[model samples]
Target chain A: MNSGRRQFIGRGGAMLAGLAIAPGMLLYDLAHGRPASGAVRWGMLIDTSRCESGCDDCVKACNKENGLSGGTGPADVQWIRKLELKDSRTGRGVSLPMMCQHCEEPPCVDVCPTAASFKRADGIVLVDRHLCIGCRYCMMACPYKARSFVHEPVHDQKPDVPRGKGTVESCTLCVQRVDRGETTACAEACAKAGHKAILFGNLNDPGSEISRRIKAVASTQIRADLGLNPGLHYEGL
Target chain B: MDLLQARRDTRIFYLLVGLGALVVAAGLVAAHYMEEYGHIVTGMNNQIVWGMPHVFAIFMIVAASGVLNVASIGSVFGKPPYKTRAPLSGLLSIALLAGGLSVLMLDLGRPERIIVAATHFNPTSVFAWNVFLYSGLFAFVGIYLWTMMEKRMNPWSRPAGLLVFVWRIILTTGTGMIFALLVARQAYGTAILPPMFIVMSFAWGLAVFYIVQAAMYGWNEMELNPAILKRLKNLLGLFILSVIYLVAVYHVTNFARHAAFERFILAEGGIYPMLFWGGYVFLGSVLPLFLIYFPRLGGKHHVLVASMLVISGSFCLLYVLIIGGQAFPLSIFPGYEARSSFGDGQIGSYAPSLPEILLGCGGLGVSFLITTIGVRALNFMPRDENTQAGD
Candidate 1:
């Protein structure tokens, strides 16, 4: 009876000690800022109805952020662009911003020879500049027409975006800012321009603004029949 | 019968080699310029990424695999008539592949990062698989040639030849999958492409072989046996017919599933339709068929003319398939007309510049130079006891 009581006390003390260390471990993790996990899936919800025609602020902002300027030729790079769509049947016109769809099963990733095209755990698709061999096979595989091959040598590149010639690039959803716990440049620009058309947030979090909007509204993917499960969803396509 | 080395100390041979080397040098210069400046110098833009260089590179690579079929027929099938020609077939496969691979490598935007491609591999990519298949082809063909030439190694010739034949099929299939596996393109995403490429390799490869054989005969001041010539011409005709049949089936299938793509390629596809009908069908296929069949109209030069037509037609087919496929606007927004900063919903245009043309021709020059050197070093000429008896 005495030994059993001592064993119970010992177990209770060990449990108390574990409880004491748990809060400190969590505080350390919070202080260090743990890397983004797969549990948080980033996504975008675009309300085309709210999008205004001839408003290229989002495109311009993306360019400024990514340092894509001075060349607008057919061969020049365009990470994001404003697309005007006119319905053939209804003759109704609408404008929207187009960029990489960031599919869960990205075809670009599948066709890349050097595994340069990849998707991060947080659902952001990116091209690894170091690994890219500039074969353009990924360009051919991309259905969204989001990718662009750097045909000429770039000058005055932003320090954050290290773009160079002979490599394929695409919209990274402002991954640098996202990593720093901020939204994409396009989304911020859209909101700043008094047009809250683009909403960027964590899709996995039910409480996130984008996720709530998607659940409340009917959102459509560009080519939904392809079953790519794109992270970018659109209302009023 | 004894094998004899070609005469190396000839003025004509030296002139031919010099001309080939000059062309290859020009190609290298063009590649250097493109690399130094950027792809902006080329006609290829955002829409049309691949251009003339791909057409030439793909053709040579496909033909390289096809040419090896001759040796396979000899060693694998034990065909007596084809046995003597196996050595030349093996040599041509290596030479043509080297030429094709050189063009493909030079056309890369980051050719310097070739080591990255070699070291880092993505198993899903057909291009990555092709790197392995292409290098393996060279090694296998080399071993196959060695087995055929070396007396002691002759015992293993059949097995080596069989392995090469199987490898070549996979190589051509991978090449076809490069375009076909893309679900994004309306012109691609079909199972027919691999088989079509296989048949194309057969036709194009045979055409290359016939031309080389004819040239070797001319160089030796000899004539091919009438029986052998007849058999080869008939085989070429059959291969051409097979290609025609495959093309018809592909169009019919596309018409049912992708009518828009079919209309773009077949009916209203400006240069594409013309190239397909006039170049590939009429001049490449139908005309060759007539020459091979009629014989009287083509006279003694029927084989040469037919082979030339086939080669020309192949170039046309590849151009239409590669360039035309890219020219058609991508269907990003179905049922809606799209306008953007990029050329969305607009037909893209690509005109091959002088540099691209020079680079393309350099591949041919490389093959020619290699062929000349190979024949000069070793006896790749076809020999027939029956022909000597007739002489």
Candidate 2:
């Protein structure tokens, strides 16, 4: 009985040691983990034909998800906005949303003095708040007018989307959600509102929904003549 | 001849320094208020991120490079008359740069993170290049000044001056490229901008130098020789004409490629057209040209008036360029007019607030104070052979 008890004690100690080493191995992987591979290129497709006027569901959802409040001043921070367009020649109008195009040759990244503006391996462009000097050169360089300078101090920020005053910001394509294998808030919100206008998927994957849609329909990039090769595309202008 | 030995502790000197100090104090206070309360108090918004502060800062920075031209002429070209003015040119360059850089740093939303700007570099960025150029200018100019002032280092003065001359051109090129490299703005993306800025520095720098030289002469009860005065005025006239030619070519080229931008700047733009025609063309270019070319109407006084007008016009021209460029909506959708909460398809409006004006004036004041102190402590007075002959 004493020998049987000794064996039981030894086995229990071994089990405890194995449990202790498990978390350290997991942490090691976390520390040395590489960024998302270039195999996945995130992109979006918008069908303006299905978009409705006066529907700000995407904007509202983006604000909520990013922890932004409505500001009436000229210097207000807005990551995404709905634009109403009118063609002078035809007198025809359409409503569409405009945000960061996330171009392959982003002018904002090129003009930033501190390398604060950077593009991820997955093609998501972001501004590092710690390094941005608020020179607004990036704002000057953005052709889409997609960037907004944070003129006021921010309070009650979402932990995931950290922002501060004097830093330039733009649409992140819901990078936090994308990392978790979820669709962007703006895309999800549009579908939930029954518009079904925005489509989000990997551009690199031919089997992805965005790729299939692009192959099926003729899509246009805004200011395509600039040769920036933007990730965002629209079906109807 | 050493100015430091001269009795410089006069009531007028103290008065000038005190006034300049007050203006600098006012600017600091305004910058503090802007940073504390947020940029909401100012006219700048998300649409017009850069405002009046940039205009002043750019002018000072450009003029700083240009002001060194007098020294370049002396040391590089071996001009006898300009040799004596080299020390003053060096002093003014340092002063103006300090003032301009101060305003630029103060205007930053995160001024505390300047160390990051200095450390982290983006090779593709024009701004990143400017960081190296700006610091290098200070260091090189400082060395050049030391070489000029120290009798033992006189042998090295010519080489140091040549190096600074080359550096200033590169520096000005970088400054011009700040706008020229912008593919986003229709008014900016031209190769001529760098050369235009180079000529602009020549014109603006000479004007500033003339004004300060006149002030110093007046304080010392000295007469500026007519021969030297004529040479300076003629040089100013030539620079003004070159600027006019460049301006014409820039507009003509822009009109051919970017018709919409040209139309907005030349005709349809509300404040832009007015500022362009009334301020830049009329006051900055034409009036100064007339004042410098035809001296009979105002005689010697006309030179001073022309210089002042030239300076004033530079401000207007920069305002039209910087503010006007941002005011026009971006042509994202070529065929479609855009309307949004962010003021899409609409011209952005800006009105300079009190704080902004004070901040600009403070830069001027800082330069003025430095010039005053520098002239008192250094032998910056121009002593031409002709003046000495008269004596």
**lDDT per residue, candidate 1, B62-103, as tens digits?**
999999878887889877678788999999999899999989
Interface RMSD of each: 0.7, 1.0
TM-score (C-alpha, index-matched) for candidate 1: 0.92
Best-fitting candidate, scored by DockQ: 2
- Screening candidate 2 with a backbone cut-off below 3 angstroms (N, C-alpha, C), the clashing residue pairs are none
Q: Score the docking of each candidate (DockQ).
A: 0.62, 0.65
CAPRI-style docking class of model 2 based on DockQ: medium
Off by over 4 Å in 2: A1-34, B1-9, B295-298, B386-391
* Ten-residue stretch with the least lDDT total in model 1 chain B: B1-10
Tens-digit lDDT track for model 1 on A1-237? 999999999999997787787854565567877666899898899999999999999998998888998356789999888899999899999899999999999999999999999999989999999999888988898898899999999888888889999899999999889988889999999999999999999999999998898999998998888889899999998
Q: How well is candidate 2 docked (DockQ)?
A: 0.65
Give residue A64's error in model 2 in angstroms.
0.9
Model 1 scores a C-alpha lDDT of 0.90
Give the TM-score of chain A, superposed on the true chain A, for all candidates in the order listed.
0.85, 0.86
Candidate 1 at residue B322, lDDT?
93
